[model samples]
Target: MDFLELVKKRRSVRAYQNKSIPDRELSKILEAARLAPSGFNAQAYKIIVIKDEKSREKLGELAKQPYISKAPIILAAVNTKLDDKYSPLDIAIALDHIMLAAAELGIGTVFVGAYHNEEIRDFVGAPNTAEMVALMPLGYPADKEIAKKRKEISELISQEKF
Candidate 1:
């Protein structure tokens, strides 16, 4: 799909079906993330694919989302080399790639940003030196949804300056 169409179609899916994601599909999605533009090519992001139910449950404990464990797959995205430069922006761009790819595969994804840092760090085996920026619960959505309500462009945008 075109970029605009893909962006328009993307939604933060919270409810998911209990289906295993194929390895090839997973790789393809990760490749999409890898191809995202990184600041200065820092390319400091890494993703841990959590297909283990126990680990998912553990993460659910940290995030307090029962569906996280039931989603059949979760991607723990972190910045392995976060520094004074551009790690957060790089990770966010990477996440956009992953989410768009998931949308292409008819998979659902929720951008999970609220969670205990220590728990998330342990769950993904992230180092104390790096920061975890995003978590995504990936699977077949139980029900498709439109995006949450938003302000109009006029309310959100300015001609040149605010």
Candidate 2:
């Protein structure tokens, strides 16, 4: 439960158990997002929680990630205000908070980025003005451990210059 350990433990969980996440736990995860820092404190985002099986299936099909439908819940992280400069970054930070909270609570999540915009908007009733930043599939993981291969710090960091 150390922060670094929690970061190391987080992974893109593709396989999930067919179990429901308790509402209290889900609320805690959302609270983490709610507390996340946003540019200018303009929390211009909305998380659309999809619990219906049919909706999940449609989203999975639209996103071309069938594994998403298997999740107990799917959250559409959207930029409600659609600010060109800060919307994407703000939404990402919020979802990161959600994911880390889920990891700490033993729930699993995957941040899905690629999807069909028009199809998803129509299916999910997302406003035409809003932007879908990412999709998150949340549930208990079927695979408990994921050995992630990360780049060495030496390969990634720069000392006062790129």
Candidate 3:
């Protein structure tokens, strides 16, 4: 699918099937993130794809987000080796790539931003220099749901002199 279509179809999948995502498809998703552009091409995002049920359970607790433990794979976005000034932006971009890629692969992904940073950082075995940025659960959707509404363009867009 095209980028726009992918974006439109992409949803924060909350439910998932019990099947495992293939290695090649997982690579494709990660490749999308790997190819994503970063500030000055620093490419500072680090992703730890979580497949272990035990780890996912631990991560779910840390994130305190129900979806984290439900999906077959949880892609934890992290950036510790890089400086903090732009870390959030960089990780977010990478996660976006992963989300779109997952859509293309007929997989569902949920981008989760709420969680306990320190607890998740430890659960993922993230290095001291790296910090947990976000949690993305990936799998096939168990059912469909309505998309959340967005603000109107007029309300969100600012004028030149705003």
Clashing pairs in 1: none
What lDDT does the true structure give each of the candidates?
Answer: 0.83, 0.89, 0.83
In model 3, which regions exceed 4 Å deviation? 82-84, 114-116
Clashing pairs in 3: 80-129, 80-130
Per-residue lDDT of candidate 3, residues 79-125 (tens digit)? 76555577678888888888888988889998888433877877678
Every model: Cα RMSD to truth: 1.6, 1.3, 1.7
lDDT of 1: 0.83
lDDT of 1 at 41: 90
Write candidate 2's Cα lDDT for 1-162 as tens digits.
899999988888999998999999999999999999988998897898999999999889999999999999999987778645787898899999999999999999989994337678667788888877789999999987667898999899989998
CA error at residue 104 for candidate 3, angstroms:
1.7
Global fold similarity of model 2 (TM-score)? 0.95
For all predicted structures, in order, the TM-scores are 0.92, 0.95, 0.91
Candidate 1: misplaced stretches above 4 Å? Answer: 114-116
